[model samples]
Target chain A: MDILHALIVLANFIIVPAIAYGSQLALGALGITLVVGVLRFSNFAHGETMAFGTMIVILMTWLFTAIGLSIYPLPTALLALPFGIIGCIAIVLLTDKFVYKFYRKAKSTPVVLVMASLGVTFIMNGLIRFIIGPGDQRFADGARFIIKARDFKTMTGFKEGLAIKVTQSITLVTAIIVVAALFWFLNKTRTGKSMRAYSDNEDLALLSGINPERVVMITWIIVAILATVAGTLYGLDKTFKPFTYFQLLLPMFAAAVVGGLGNPVGAIVGGFIIAFSEISFTYAYKKVFTYLLPADWAPTSLVQLLSTDYKFAVSFSILVLVLLFRPTGLFKGQST
Target chain B: MTGGYGTGADILHDCTVAVNKGEIAVIVGPNGAGKSTAMKAIFGMLTMRSGQVSIDGEDITNLSPQDRVAKGMAFVPQNQNIFTSLSVEENLEMGAFLREDDISETMHQVFDLFPILKERRKQAAGELSGGQRQQVAVGRALMTQPKVLMLDEPTAGVSPIVMDELFDRIIDVAKTGISILMVEQNARQALEIADKGYVLVQGENRFTDTGSNLLSDPEVRKSFLGG
Candidate 1:
């Protein structure tokens, strides 16, 4: 292999996918961070919430597809997304009213809220599994690749080529749109200011006449939108399964903590870092790095830092390293 | 007994100081005095075991801090008084969260009162100095257009130079016809501008008189004033 071939392979296989994956993780992490910071609890059920929202979109897509209404060139799920978001918001609001609201009224500690979220998580997990049958579902179709690898090679006349997937483009674009909307809502609006104030100091926020319950409701709604977008994008990129969705908790949390949980921009940055590290470490560098080393020294068995199967371990290790060195994460989140 | 209470840490034991609609009433005490506790009790931040707190003669002894706020009472705590992460403008807006009116006019008035804050309107409240932070806290309380503004040790950590300036602002706020009830660590200075002054010690009233009378009192001067 030559330097040109290696570089192309690295860019095509590692860089592009990492950015899309990071964007997905960032959106999910931001939702988790907000819940923890403002609501003062580590919401264990967030992964399941993402799953639930995506499941709704998948179900809606199936229904729409059956009715002969395809979006064409884009996944029909894209059209079903708004309805999915609404469903997610309703579910979250209802959960807050019945479950979390009681704990809040009693002034329960954050740990208790964490436990409550765990219970909610289990319930949502069970509900999704029962309804969606806990199986991998391929709901995305119609123009799966923006540029096929064969097409890329033909176009460029290079030994290596660049390929972009339709799902990957959707992931990047959707993440950008969602993040921009979120920041705008948080920084430039009255209710958004109230939410930040409430997050900063709940007692003072109350004294300032902010309705805590209302802020919580709004927070849940925003979280629902982010979760739906994240989940759908992830499913579109990969395959959707209830079990896999539930298992995403570790990476999502790692992303949030690495980015400095509760800091929005930090979560985004953290997501990219985690995604890139996972990909770069697991990527079989024999194809990419064989070009750089001497022929004898390069005699290797897939020079990879870790197996792809251990992706979760990578996230956990990074999370532990971050916590040990910088307990507040990359950003100085709420010490209060 | 203090503020009419016979036992316990009754900071305002048997004490009754009224603002009378538009007067500045200052409460002065030693370091261990219950001045702040009394204010907290009045504002419903502390539970009153047995005392009546009223506003315009309506009983509000059991109201929460939020309820008290709704009933036209505003309190500025001595510490952590404002949302530090929020911008100066946001902090002021929070003060008027319950008001449905267009508070841009009130915000303008607040800016005029504290011109420095106006220059740093977009800056976070946490970045401000002690005196400026105190101004934000006070300005937030004023947004409610309350009948009475209760302040807890407004000059506690402020520099002496800034303390005098803050006092001047307080006096100016008093002229706006809002009743002022302040707990002061700087007893002499606080009493000087006060329409009525109450001296408390060990959770009980030590002296009650006009500001000049209390300032000149031989006993008050010996204990709280370091005379």
Candidate 2:
């Protein structure tokens, strides 16, 4: 019974949040990997892309609320997601045309493209902040809990209660559906195969009659959808603050690099690895240990490896270690 | 043909080579002889300073490489030709990308030509041996049902045995009534199978004749063929 209680406590604090956060990170990392693989640059503006999408979704959600629109038990933001995606697509396409395309035409190096993306990052950051006023926005309007703690305790007849949030469940289910759909599209469709071919060998893809412009357009559209979905889900789970999304660039890139940059499967596995590490390390595990150890033998300390405030440090350390030891990352993706 | 990379001086000067339908044309020369350059010029890879490339009497000099593919032209480059990350079947599928009709018949045909490829159809091209990778490259180009197949050093970096096998396969492909245009480093062997051969010297056509004629010529043998 003590063991069961310990497991429940672990689930309540660590497992659930890690899965949700991992899903968000996976989606974010996918966007980064796709751009890096196809467009051949690390897009510093991706976080801004997410923040801008979330800002659009937030505005649309408020409008929907003003018009007395509600999904009842579900968040109204879900309905506005498509609009946010479209807005994000437009902005990304515009950036490609005005900024990245010129550099691509000039055949600039990847470093130059990275610098150009940083410039885009500043512009998008300013735009998002100017429009949204850079404050925390909690727009989640839904049944907040799929499984309440009181109900779980009552049903299980246990001292430890397991609570699952509605958003957390939605995040897991949505992530599964989205990830499955993405893999299916990439593996099965003609355009998807061409995209893979383009990524594999750009010159060969052209010689095979693939239109580079079309491939680029499709990639940006997919990235927009991914970024919007991920950003909105993260917002629903936590809070929508522009700065928070901007800061997310760290863990997101870490996830991409650790999973092997430019490899989609690696990005996903890397996401969960980073998320679980961050959560498990920061979580005070004295309770779980107390359940397993005799009271006299148990330590008085919190048994937390690190505080939540230093969460990004964990990501940074892992990123550095991975870069130093295995530069190709876990999946041995393209070195360039 | 006369062209060079991006506003540079012409590498090829009045270099002309052609292959009739159902025939094999081979280009042979020493290193830096502009053999590959002439092939690229015909494939629309580089902008020609002054030249006319025609396929079945239709001018194709102005066409882009993609447009050339639409016009029933397929080229297999010497290096990095196949989609390395994709499976052999997927690589072949990408070959027929522009086609609107069913391609299973074409795919089966490719598999039949390269039986080993069929056995390892699910394997990634990058994992294959050098000779097998060349087969995938050729099979991918054939997926378009091309009228003219152009190859740039198809047997490069392979063992002599593999080279002979690749030449045998090239003969089989030519037997299917598609005209083949190829540049080869194995000058004598290439000429043996070629219906027509051109020996390029310093980007200029020094010898253009029937394959047997070039092979039997004393001057050609002493200079280019290394007698």
Task: Give the CAPRI rating of model 2.
Answer: high
Best by TM-score: 2
A216-331, model 2: which lDDT tens digit per residue?
Answer: 99999999999999999999999999899999999999999999988999999999999998899899999999887887878799999999999999999988988998888899
TM-score versus the correct structure, for each prediction: 0.94, 0.98
Query: What are the DockQ scores of the candidates, in order?
Result: 0.76, 0.90
Highest DockQ against the true fold, candidate:
2
Candidate 1 is graded, for docking, as: medium
Q: For model 1, what TM-score does chain A reach?
A: 0.97
> For candidate 1, lDDT tens digit of each residue in B112-216?
999998998999999999999999999999999899999998998989999999999999888988899999988899999998998877777778888889889
* Weakest 10 consecutive residues of candidate 1 chain B by summed lDDT: B1-10
**iRMS (Å) per candidate:** 0.9, 0.5
Could you tell me the lDDT of residue A298 within candidate 1?
Answer: 81
